[model samples]
Target: MQNTPPRSRIEIDRLRKIFLAEGREVVAVDDASFRIDDGEFVALLGPSGCGKSTILNMVATLIAPNGGAIRVDDAPVVPGRPIAQVGYVFQKDTLFPWRTVEGNIGYALELAGVPTGERKTRVAEAIHQAGLDGFDRFYPASLSGGMRQRVSLMRTLIARPEILLMDEPFGALDTHTKLDMHSVLLSLWERERQTVLFVTHDLGEALTLADRIILMSARPGRVKADFKVDFPRPRDAVKLRETPQYAELFSKVWHSLGEEFAKGRSA
Candidate 1:
């Protein structure tokens, strides 16, 4: 008997999306294609308004693609009801103001109909994983910005997703906090080897976290360049930037992204 190959974690082929603005058709993404291997971390890095988030939404099935296909584990993605095997952490905290940290993290579990007994166990584990153990009973307003984002992470992790999609999750935090969160995210990613497709305009974040970075052009986005990060795994996000290799890659990616920024400014 022949053994079957492991299915790709994500396959986006000829993916496209268009929007109607002021009665004018605007192409958000034009023929973006890429593949992500199981357990790999990939970053979609591009200029602002380059459709990085649009493509992410398309892959998440929160929005339908105007054309082409997206598959997760070889299964077709259904629009608006994407694959449940995925978790999403957004650019801003989405915690409910009325709910305690415990309540917030358990919301998804509650919706999934997980037994209360099991949910308690899972929620506790997620809280500990996110360093929110003592803050479990606290409300969202009380936690610092970084702490709130941790709640968002724990909230998603409680679902036990195999794939995680992050769109500029730390973009609003202070530089120090952002770096800390990078460490936290990397540690969690190392534990499970979960497939991640992160969308960010931050080159440093992409270089520190991803196995590959896909660059996209300005509006009416298309794949501009795809570069393998080639950094060693189990990396230390705080120290990763100090390496000679990191500097070299930074120069290369900045050059590509710089051109896109110029195009956006001129248009």
Candidate 2:
């Protein structure tokens, strides 16, 4: 019998991106390489303008890279052709002001031509999962920032994408709300087990959610370090911070990350 070769859910090799700003070329990412296996949650950590979001945009096929290659399931990522298996959540909630929570969450299903009955059922389940049951009829304008983001998250999750790309999804929330959002995300991830590439500059957020942390250097981003987060599964995002182990690892990773921050400041 022939053995099957190992395949990664997402593979990036020598990925480079350059942006033209004011008629000058600025390198965003250079020689970046990484692989995310099925169901792994990885965090891309770096200071602002480190090309973290740029990488996610490239993976989602929102933009073409200036050099190198990105592969999903061993297939090259082509510009203008979005991978159906991927979903993205941006920094903002981006909810439609006119749409109620239920309507927003079910929008994707409707777009896919799912029957109204089926869409309602799925939307109800997603609303429940996101803890927005009673608020289903409420518009995004009325919901709190955290609540709005929950709707945005469920909106993408309802599509059941195999890969999730989140770009600072909770960055706008206050500390308390951010922690709450963290718990919600952790619960959803535990249940769904989607391969996630989360981009954030917040170390605690990364440490709380990721199975591994891929630290990127300042401008002209490159892989600075790959740190495995050995914290056990089904993590309580809030309680994890109190553990001595969490603090130790935080210190270690922060040391490396802090250096990049300093470099970014100097530049």
Instruction: Please tell me which predicted candidate would have the highest lDDT against the true structure.
Output: 2
**Root-mean-square deviation per candidate:** 1.7, 1.5
lDDT of 1 by residue, 65-182 (tens): 8899999889899997857789999989999999999999999999989999999999998889888878899999999999999999989977889999999999999989998899
Off by over 4 Å in 1: 1-6
Worst 10 residues of 1 by lDDT: 3-12
RMSD of 1: 1.7
1-267: candidate 2 lDDT, tens digit per residue: 998765599999999999999999999999999999999999999999999999999998999999899999889999889789999999998888889999999999989999999999999999999899899999988999999999999999999999999999999999999999999999999998999999999999999999999999999999999999999989998889999999999999999999999999999
> How many angstroms is residue 65 displaced in model 2 relative to the true structure, after the best TM-score fit?
0.5
Which 10 consecutive positions of candidate 2 have the poorest summed lDDT? 3-12
Evaluated against the true structure, the overall lDDT of model 1 is 0.92
Model 1 residue 122 lDDT?
92
